[model samples]
Target: MKTGNKIKLFLVDDDAVFLKALQIQFMENDDFEVETFSTGELCIQNLNKKPDIVVLDYHLDGIVKNAINGMQTLDKIKETNAGIPVIMLSSQDKIEVAVSCMHHKAFDYVVKSETAFVRLQKVISNIFKYQKMEKELNWYMDRM
Candidate 1:
């Protein structure tokens, strides 16, 4: 990918070890510019940076169940920038949770596992393709 096409990715998870691992993985890959946060609040605070994609954990510390969770974070993110795509991360394998994330407009959801990195790569590629098409469409509309 060209330098101008490199995607900015933000990862938010409460697990410090997981965050560090993901940071290292992305750093080794040239396609992504990765930033990580240990809390959803920190990620929200950095919205001005306009990251192209956000990877969010399903459960967060200090957030009440059935009230505020990753789904709530997803909503807040969309409120801030509706066009920004988000990928929900969860250890849960329940289909309901995955469906809920999709219903709430998550770009994709992946279960935490050894293959998580592979899934993330696929999601990033799809998001990039969608974003590129969106940008082109908007440009064409502007020329009309």
Candidate 2:
């Protein structure tokens, strides 16, 4: 999609306050159209809406009994549509968690903190830039 169009984003986190804050934060940006979900199941159920990107929390707790964690949710999402970019969010900064997220095809893994939203903005910008370049390359390839 082009920059002229608002990027559809799905924000999935078990924290009600955090989720709402994220939705509000993204709403300030003209480039984003945000949707908030509290659990992996809700996020998965709305996949038909086809968001351009998904911000999924690493641990989904308290929302449901045995709710899918971010990694499992990532797997399920990729199973349905591998192309959708996903940014995995967690409060922990462990190497193994980051590697696992990458293994599951997450676009990026980010640790939650005071600066998390700022970093997320940067990642989203990068994803858009990369996607634009991919589209241009595909268009060139089709011309050959």
Candidate 1 residue lDDT tens string, 1-144: 224666788998887888789889988988788999766777888999999899999987643344356777899999999888999999999999999999999999999999999899888888877877888999999999
lDDT of 2 by residue, 23-136 (tens): 888899888899998999999999999999999999998679889888889999999999999999999899999999999899999998888899999998898899889989
The count of backbone overlaps in candidate 1 is 0
Model 2 CA deviation exceeding 4 Å by range: none
TM-scores, one per candidate: 0.86, 0.93
Question: Candidate 2 has which clashing residue pairs, if any?
Answer: none
RMSD of each: 2.8, 1.5
Candidate 1: which stretches are off by over 4 Å? 1-5, 62-68, 135-144
Worst 10 residues of 2 by lDDT: 1-10
